[model samples]
Target: VNCNCDYGCPCQFNARPTDGTCRAVVAWRIDSGHFGDTRLDGLHAVNIYAWPGAIHEGNGSMQSIIDERASDAQRTALVAILQGEGADPGAVMLQIYRTMCTAAHEPLYEPIHLDIDIAERTARLSIPGLVDSAVEPIRNPVTGAPHRARVDLPFGKEFRLAEVASGRTRATGVIPLELANT
Candidate 1:
């Protein structure tokens, strides 16, 4: 995930954004999963979002991009899951995000290239002509030594533990974004 915020996004802590607005591009690569018997392993998806104010204030724009290699059934299942269908209300993060957005653009099918190594704190994601993003370990400003940190949310719906890293993103789709060191 990359956004127009400082290295540690304040939003995660329920704080306002660094700037007064919010814009982010988040991508996920499913290593192993199933959506109603439709295998979602090795598939990738991306979500781009922007808001004039805090997320809870509404009036946001969002778009989804899915891997073009997925089959028809896989595409349908992915779309359904991402759009928050067939899940208990507000149980999934995507569902909550969808409700906060006023504009939800049509999903796009595109070629996606994603490589992630969570243990190494490195990731690279690219979609031809659409988005390019990367994640890397954070470094100390003075010593230039790699800094490691993690956020643990015991009851969080989105995740239980997350490694904090630096991220950069450039997107040129319906919801364009250019984020650095976020």
Candidate 2:
């Protein structure tokens, strides 16, 4: 996930953004998972979002992208899950994010390449003409050495623990985004 915020996004702590607005590009690589009986393994997806104000204030726009290698059935199932269908209210991050956005652009089926290593605090995501993003360990301002940090949300819906690293993203789509060191 890359967004226009300082390292350690304030939103994770329920605080206002570093700036007044919000723009983000997030990608997910499903190593192994299942949506009911559907085998959702080795698939990737990306979401782009922007808002004029805080997320809860509404009037946001979003675009979804799915891996082209998925089968028809896999695509349908992934779309449903992305749209928050059949899930209990606010049970998932995608579901909650969808409700906050007013404009939902048509989803794109395209080639996606993603690699993530949580322990190493490294990641790379590419969607051809859509986006190019990467993540790496934060560096110490004085020593220029890799600085490691983490965030743990005991009851958070998005993730239980996340390695806090620097992220950069450039996206060109319905909801464009350009973020650096965030």
**What TM-scores do the predictions have?**
0.95, 0.94
Writing each residue's lDDT as its tens digit, candidate 1 over 29-79 gives 999999989999999998899999888888998988999999999999988
User: lDDT score of model 2?
Assistant: 0.87
Q: In candidate 1, what residue range of length 10 has the lowest lDDT sum? A: 3-12
Give every collision pair in model 1. none
Candidate 1, which segments miss by more than 4 Å at Cα?
none
Write the residue-wise lDDT of candidate 2 on 1-182 in tens digits.
88898887788788898897889988888989988889989999888899888787878898889899999888988888887888788888788888889998998999999998876779999888989999999999999999998889998667888778898999988777888888
Global lDDT scores for all candidate models? 0.89, 0.87
User: Alpha carbon lDDT of residue 1, candidate 2?
Assistant: 85
